[model samples]
Target: MSDSTAAWVAAGVRSVIGAHTQAQDAGRTDDVVALYTPDAVLELPGMDPIEGHDALREAFKSWAPTQPQLHLVTNTVVTPGAEGEATATSDVAFLQRGESGWAVHLVGHYEDTLRRHEGGWRLHRRSTTFQ
Candidate 1:
């Protein structure tokens, strides 16, 4: 891919990541699942790897917070590859609001594999490592 094409792919990958966090934070389970491929896999820190869109939807719904929550994603680095594939790593700060105030709930890094789909870029696999 040319440098310009690579740049565009990187931006698209980052957008997908950002959209996932935003949708989840807003408790939009369906929207969050839409960001992934139909057969996507989500691996959180503790639980087993949740496979496919149905499982992903259920997992996100079950984890919906009672209070406000936010996921701050930063330092995202995307590596473009052949065949419409890419990988990304990002630092994430998961925050939740309680009676006291907003506090950090978890600190983690994400390793993600993405692919260009008919609709757009979608996450094929996402693995989180908590710190």
Candidate 2:
């Protein structure tokens, strides 16, 4: 495949992470659902893999109301096939209001399986690893 095509695919997957981080920063949970595929699944170490759009959206929405500020950092590690799917990983950091001061937290390694969609690329699955 051409370098530009590869880059574009990589960028598309990377943007899903961007969208989530941006929305989190803006306290906008409504759009979080669109960050993943309709059948997307999320696996965070201690938690079960959250499946489907409705549940995932709801989970994020729960946090959205709290208005946490977040930042995401990602790297598209590879484009394995011509199907426009890729693997990427990200780091997410945020701060939330607390009794005394803002508490800072970091979630790392969002290993993702991304697929090409009508609009672009969407996250198919995410496996989170604690740092």
Candidate 3:
């Protein structure tokens, strides 16, 4: 994929993440798995890595309620990879709710593996590390 194509895919992925979370809190528990490829995986610090689109959707399900109030920040770059693929690296910040207020806030870097499929660029693997 070209740089512009990679950029669009990265933007689309983030947009879907934001939109789906918003919709989930609004009472539509529609399938979130469709946003990802079949074999996608996501790894977050202190949590087990999620494999497959179904698992990813389940992971999102667990975060549904808090998503509405949480503030999600992402800064990303998508670079072309060998063999017509691309990679996306994003700096992420998330604030989780706490009794006193939001306290479990985190800053992290996300390393994502992307490949160009018939549909477009899709995430294959994603791992994040805390700052």
Candidate 4:
């Protein structure tokens, strides 16, 4: 792929992470769900895959009360595929406030599949493996 194509794909992947962090921090479950495709699935270790936006919304609701202080996304690697599809992997660090202040709630890596949707990229599948 050309440099521009690579950059564009990378940006799209980063946008997904940015939107996710913003939505979660704002406690907008619906907005968080909107970052994925209608039929998207999210898999977390030891839990059933969260299938579809509705299920995603419910899952987010259950977790929102924790009031995460921050969600950091880093080390993103995006690989373009044919037919407007791409795969991305990134490290995610989640923090929450404790008596001592912000401490890590979770640290993980996300394996994601994204597709071009309405002139932008949207995640179709994501699997999280905690570190």
Q: Which candidate is the best by TM-score?
A: 1
lDDT of model 3 at residue 33? 54
Predicted candidate 4 versus true structure: per-residue lDDT over 1-131, tens digit per residue: 89998888888878887898888887889888888888899999999999998899999988784544787888889898887889998899988887888899789999999988777788899999999
Instruction: Give the RMSD in angstroms, all C-alphas superposed, for model 2.
Output: 2.4
- lDDT by residue (18-41, candidate 2, tens digit) is 887787677676677787889999
Model 1 per-residue lDDT tens digits across residues 8-106: 999999999999999999899999999999989999877899999999999999988789999999999999988789999999999999999999989
lDDT of 2: 0.73
Candidate 1 vs candidate 3, TM-score winner: 1
In order of appearance, the predictions have TM-scores of 0.97, 0.82, 0.67, 0.92
- Candidate 1 or 3, higher lDDT? 1
lDDT of each: 0.93, 0.73, 0.65, 0.87
Candidate of highest lDDT: 1
Cand. 3 TM to true fold:
0.67
Off by more than 4 A, model 2: 65-68, 74-82, 97-103
RMSD of 3: 3.7
